[model samples]
Target chain A: MTTFQPLDIVRTSATVTTAPPAGRDVEVAKLIDVSKCIGCKACQSACLEWNDLREPVGTNLGVYDNPHDLTPNTWTLMRFTEWENPQSGNLEWLIRKDGCMHCEDPGCLKACPAPGAIVQYANCIVDFQHDACIGCGYCEKGCPFNIPRVSRIDNKAYKCSLCSDRLAIGQQPACAKACPTHAIMFGTKTEMLAQAEKNIGVLKTRGYSKAGLYNPPGVSGTHVMYVLHHADQPQLYAGLADNPSISPLVEAWKGIGKYAGMAVIGATALIGAFHYLVRGPNKVSAHDEDEAKRLAEAPK
Target chain B: MNDKAPSGAPVRVPRYSGSARINHWIMAIAFVILLLSGLSLFHPALFFLSGIFGGGAMVRWLHPWAGVVFALGFLMLFIRFLPANLPELTDFKWLAKIRYVVSGRDEFLPEVGKYNAGQKLVFWSQAALVPIMVVSGFALWTPGLDFLQSTFGIKATMDHRRLAAVVHAAAAVTTIVIWIVHVYAAIWVRGTLSAMIRGSVTGGWGWRHHRRWLKREVADGHVKSG
Candidate 1:
């Protein structure tokens, strides 16, 4: 006996289409508790010595953040931001150590005209090669934060190399080593991310409701993550720009376009030349007949 | 490709005059030098390339000057091709096939007079960018502008040098991207470099390629050296 069904579904076929799949898991970094940071310049000093960057070339203008923000010479910086809220009746000063996040999708890498000038390493650290940098300043356009500073000297791009040399030796980054308060934590991407989550949990438990993490996934995901003091509150987190992203395949896809333009342009130029070959010399240019006339009229 | 062949001597008609060629070569040399040096300086690894000009210091000093020379080359190109490159009603038609022109398949891409869409775009970009770099460049140079001092030697609002710097950077970036496409296109198409340098091309290569242009040249007059 056939069982009677209330509804019968029609037999269907599956559509199989080929497309690029999303990437697999890759490591990234986590950052400091702004409240825990005591305005110490430990990380800054460590980064400088580790990278062997020269001393500050120029002094600050007026801001308390000495040596000002990061430069071509100074890779890591402790940015001092002061906020005075009228309603809260509070004056807060925060120091954020800013440098190359070594983003999974680094803007510099996208904007670079010269291949291999700026690259991404295993852990997503934004890496730079001095020899390869053409200093065309394309990376400058690519960066959302405008991090990589171009030195006037060589026109080469400059930014934090993420202590690529140190990472190769399997040592903690210099800034982390130098931090007296353990404010700047450095470790494997997974471990650091786990640590960041725990720290944020604790901050929230301790009557600090605004404490949250700042690891927006879009910018190729960052090797450097953050546990921002006010990540939760819209008033505080609102300043952060949303959707930090980069083009995946820029010139890579343009290879086809380049060839197409060449074929047409080349054909045109050669046609002009061939015409001259068959007809004999003394052709007027595409324009400038008056000049040709002037030349003919002039005495030799 | 001479007017004075067979029964007559090969006649010379000026295509690129001596002054024009000299300007072009200088610009090209300057660009190469600056490009190599600039690349070296962009990253530390290539810093050794400082030798193209001299060294890092030399690259630094020469970069702006090279930019100035590159701009000057445009001045000459403007002097030469301004008339041919002027925007025309046909330009829009040529521009419409930009995608087809780049695709390499559309044999009937668009009939253009002298400079086609792609070449025109490149030329026009160069024209606009040259002056921009010059103006923004001066703003970037230290002591770029004199400050208007108030009563007690207090300099008033300083001009937006940073803005100029940003503009300069934007122009530089745009130029580099264009240069990449320019060079890539030059190499990608066969025998292009030969035509520009030697000033000649094959016959059939002309007809199937630039039928209109070739037809004009052959039917109207002869190719001659100045």
Candidate 2:
């Protein structure tokens, strides 16, 4: 449990004014080399043990993945996709680790309405504060990658924090530390990028022509990246978003729409007040009372 | 059966029934609750308003329930008032001379029915916007969405939830503006609040603002002359 200082936070949800930290922290990243992975479940177990989470035992649905989908307790998952290489006519099993990407611009942070519910650290780690969460699930809608999962029991959202706790204590993430194949590498972003480049070079020499890095620029590049053999089609790795970005609808709702709507509401109230003061009340006149009396008397 | 006042006193004409007044008030109160709770979650500046509702979580829990109550109350008002709120040729004329209507120049305006054109506009616009609020609101509701998915095998996708959020917020803003207009109109027109509060208005009030409606009440013996 590392104590976080105000200077550690780069951004906070629903905050109007946030001063930039005095100095920048060295940005860190987790690089997953897909070609070197062996579909082992050590990372998942390590995450559970390190986080002290106990996910309920679930029945197998005839798949290699356990607990079918990401849940509140299960922050990390191994998604298996069996694809056939058309050129080589070989069936290949692509296993990808699925969790929060911790983007430079996190949609979850943008859409959160509760003040201080979500925060982005200087190291590019996005984390949620359960105490301030209102359980509205707006973060779920804002996420382009559909990472955050709102727990039914607590009504608070849960997702991977990229092991910010461990990182603060100068240790790698639990999943990265537990990877037996050294597939998940953790270090400064520059070192990881260089390492990914070296791995991609080795992969190309082994005849994976389309191998490349999966740090999508749509969300200004994620701290968590992947080196995919078929980077051109990330969907091959179990429905990974090809071009992930915050939805335009979310942007509109949280961006211009919010400010404009508030302005219009304020203007309407002010206009009503001004009109009342200027025009005064529409009172009934004496002549109208006389007419009403005469009409009542003359009526059959 | 008429409890008449002394001679030379003013007459009173019935406008809304007791039940109708009660229904209207319930709807009004529910709308107010929704507005405060909704505003608390809408912007950071208004977040302090949540303190009245206990906190942010409380407001979140109360908002949708208040929405349901509002929808039910509005539904009754819609059915009861629909006959009187139907658009007429004079409604267009009244709208055309809206400037005069606002300036307290009733002579330039046509004789109106139980509801004026502005009131009718509030009625119909709410009738259209409330359903949008309810449907989109359900999509954004966490428990509601879960129940829908688990019970009916209807899963609301993230895209659906996103669209619902935008649509709900837009409709809420429009409704809030319209509500402001409605409340201000009541305050601007003297003797109008009494009609909803006591279920009757003075004959002079009807004659000044709604002569046609007054004449019908007199002919039908709904007015008690003193």
Candidate 3:
């Protein structure tokens, strides 16, 4: 069992005050080499077992991928995409493990309305605290990747924790440890980037001219990076967002909108109060009552 | 309260009936409930408000039903007051001299009716924004009802959901501001609260603020004086 430690929380949800900057630590990262993945579901099974998640038996939806999509139970999934290169006249099976990207500027943390529901550690792990969750699903709207899932049974938000528990005990994440081909590697971000560059060099020698890393800068580069053979066309590999970032709408709603709304409401009430103080209540004068009485007493 | 100003009693004309007052109060109470519940979910600073509704889950569950009650009550009010609130020629003149009305110098303003230009503005704003809150609210709510997704033509895509969410929050903020103005005006104008509570205003109140309406009522022989 992983013991609880005073985590160096770098970000917290729905908090106005900035978090104390005491927990500065070396950032960690997870690199997934898509080219080496063989469509094996070992990582998915490992994630389920380690997380103790019992995803209900689901039906075949005319696809090899089971459970259809990520759910409250299924935190990690293997997405398979088959594409044929028109020039080579050959099919390419692109298998990618899809889960939380653990964005440096997480949109879910920005959008969550409940304080402390979602937090990002100094080590680049974004975790959800269900006790603080309101289950309003604002995080879904805030997330550009749509990673969080709200459970109707528990009425709390759920998502991948990046196995923060294991990391605390100095153990590799279950998915990365279970990767048969060493496709998933976990280490400090600097080390992972160096490894990713070497993997790209190997792919370049194998005639993959467009091979590169999929660490989109839109969300300030994700902690979970992908080394892809066809990184030039990430969308070809299961709709991997070519340029993913927080949506402008989410930013406006969470950013200026929050402050502006409070200002407008406060200003309007203040103006009303001022008006009342300046000009007293509009009262009915005694002269007006006499006039009404005179008019009512007069009959035709 | 029982009968319309019996003979030899202080002159009091009926404004709202018993049912009308009940409806208005129901709408008022529901509006307050929805505002607190919705704001609690809007920002973390106000999340403690969820305790009033039992908890976060209860707030999430009860918000929509409260919206339903508010919508139904507002719809009835819309139908009941629409005829009185329609824009007329005097309303334009009244709006033009809004300065005098705000400054409590109503002698320079146009003679008003059952509803003034300011009151009409509140009614019309609620008319426009309540439906917005209702429609966008349904879109944001992701309960077990998948059929509702098709009803609004929302494809259940993230983009559609995001747009609906933004619109809903904006409309809610706007509506709350208007509500504050409405409540403030009612409090500022003495005798206005009685119209909604006891269902009548003093004849002096009618004569001073709404002389045209009072004249019409007297001409129609609907007045009695002690």
Best by TM-score: 2
Point out where model 3 deviates above 4 Å.
Answer: A1-7, B1-10, B144-147, B150-153
Ranking by DockQ: 2, 3, 1
lDDT of 3 by residue, A184-277 (tens): 9999999999999999999999989999999999999998999999988999877899999999888878888777877888899999999999
Kindly provide the TM-score of model 3 when superposed on the true structure, using C-alpha atoms: 0.95
Q: Compared with the true structure, what per-residue lDDT tens digits does model 1 show for residues B1-226?
A: 3332322222222234456667767877877776676555343345567765655545656777787787778787788878867777767886776665554433555555545667677888988887887777655443222221222343322124434544555565566666666665555544345455655543333433344554455445644323
Q: Write the per-residue lDDT of candidate 1 for residues A1-300, one digit (tens) a residue.
A: 011111211110010122222433245464766667887788877777776778645766877565776688778777777777554778877667777766766666655545445555445566666676655554655565557777767667788766656765676678777888877888777888788888888888976677777676777467777787677542342234455554332222122322344444456557545644544432223222333333333443
Q: What TM-score does prediction 1 earn?
A: 0.57
lDDT of 1 at B23: 71
What's model 1's overall lDDT?
0.58
Listed models, DockQ each: 0.07, 0.52, 0.48
Error of 2 at B189 (Å): 1.0
Recovered share of real interface contacts in candidate 1: 0.00
Give me candidate 2's interface root-mean-square deviation.
4.6
Candidate 3: clashing pairs of residues: none
Candidate 1 backbone clash number: 33
Q: Model 1 off-target regions past 4 Å?
A: A1-28, A57-60, A153-155, A232-242, A247-300, B1-67, B73-226
